[model samples]
Target: MSNSSLPEERELLRQIARGDESAYTLVFNHYSKQVFNAAMLYLKNTTPAREVVQEVFLKIWLKREAMSDVEDLTGYLFILTRNHIYDSFKKQATQLKAVDNFVQLQPDAIEDTDYRLQERQYDHLLNRAVSSLPPERKKVYIARKEGLSNEEISHKMNISIHTVKKQMQLAVQTVRSFVKQQLHI
Candidate 1:
């Protein structure tokens, strides 16, 4: 749709709009790495970044008719990827809130005691995990645990937001692995 797009690329888009599987495969092969790298810059993990890549491509396939009208294919894909990541973050937040609410709700006396004990054991394991983190990662993990946004952590630690996110991701993975190992799970 844009004058700047190469003739071959424009034809590729048109072919995609016409439901050409080979064209779609070409587009996927050409763009998947860019999409995945963009996702990794934010997600800081392979699984979620890979998920974003798949979801973005799936959307492109589902809405192939719109490909012809896209003025900038890369920009369109980036927007789709960014939106998906935002939705993922929002879903995670909602789930966390739901879990928090469930924890706060009163239960039968026996259930409450058992729940409390389990919670304490989990917390103790998590604390040990946190304690074992490297100093910088520990700070990032604690800041995040205290409910600081990534931006807030970045400012407080005088580091890039990307660093904050990466440190947080690594800290979480380490803590999860430690807890799992401790529980023999």
Candidate 2:
């Protein structure tokens, strides 16, 4: 436990509570790397660790008014970091289970040849649809397909995270429509 009475960090918390941007910047500069390291230790991925850092700070900013009451700010921040990492694991597990269930729901009797043909057809249609997207949207779509997080895609593409999400949503809808049309589904 760091000395809670340390004037620098305590004063930073005060300024943050008062909505000081420089104070927020100072806190972020001081703690961002530590948070990222802790997140990486747990999440084991650069993108998700970066996301954890962003989310922790965002939460701090949103809850700044309550900072004065926190005795050990450093400890509080780490608690938030651990909680966020745990939430990420829970979300990932749920997604994996859903994927497992979907796989299990597939017809067991579908022969290899028929499955391979269907897969090839879907791949061809998906490739065609992806190639038709505008350059930036296509990049976002490809990054998402490669399992990059929205934050990672946004950083790589020099765009806002919201834009990454919107572009991905549009790309998915367009591809789904195109594939459905081809399959008469």
Candidate 3:
């Protein structure tokens, strides 16, 4: 695990620590495919796998100064990628649980008149919340609701993937806050 054991990677890390984009790019190009493949093996979806690659590299770049301290670059990247995927899974599970709770709170029979009325009211509130979003955020929110991936939204909107993610995050927060206010929840 000594620096001498990975002399080339050690040099790349040193360069990256000094804010060298070329060195960072070299490390990215060398490992991105492997990272994508590893992610695909677990995620079983191209979009999420691609997102993992982006997130892992972004973390690396952001923490470049610590790169030189990493004894094994490959091991460090693997840990980062694995941690991110686990986080994604946890977030998905939490969201699904929230939706499940919301559904469970409703009457069991959809044929109930009161249930139908409540459903409509909820839908109306949600629509209003969405409509109140900024134009770009609304677009991102709608695209996601339509089952488009972030990459697809980025390409369709001609924005960077990071921007698309940011917009979607902001849109969700805004809509959630608006709905909570409207529902007094």
lDDT of 2 by residue, 35-151 (tens): 888888887899989999999999999998987677787788789999998987899999999999888766554566688998998899899989989899999999998999999
| RMSD after CA superposition, every candidate | 26.5, 26.9, 28.2
Q: What TM-score goes with each of the models? A: 0.55, 0.54, 0.55
Predict model 3's lDDT versus the native. Answer: 0.88
What lDDT is obtained when candidate 1 is compared to the true structure?
0.89
Candidate number of the best lDDT: 1
Better of 1 and 2 by TM-score: 1
Q: Give the poorly placed runs of model 3, Cα more than 4 Å off.
A: 1-7, 108-185
Local error of candidate 1 at residue 135 (angstroms): 75
* Alpha-carbon local distance difference test for all models: 0.89, 0.87, 0.88
Task: Give a tens-digit lDDT track for model 1, residues 158-185.
Answer: 9999999999999999999998899999
Pairs in clash, predicted candidate 2 = none
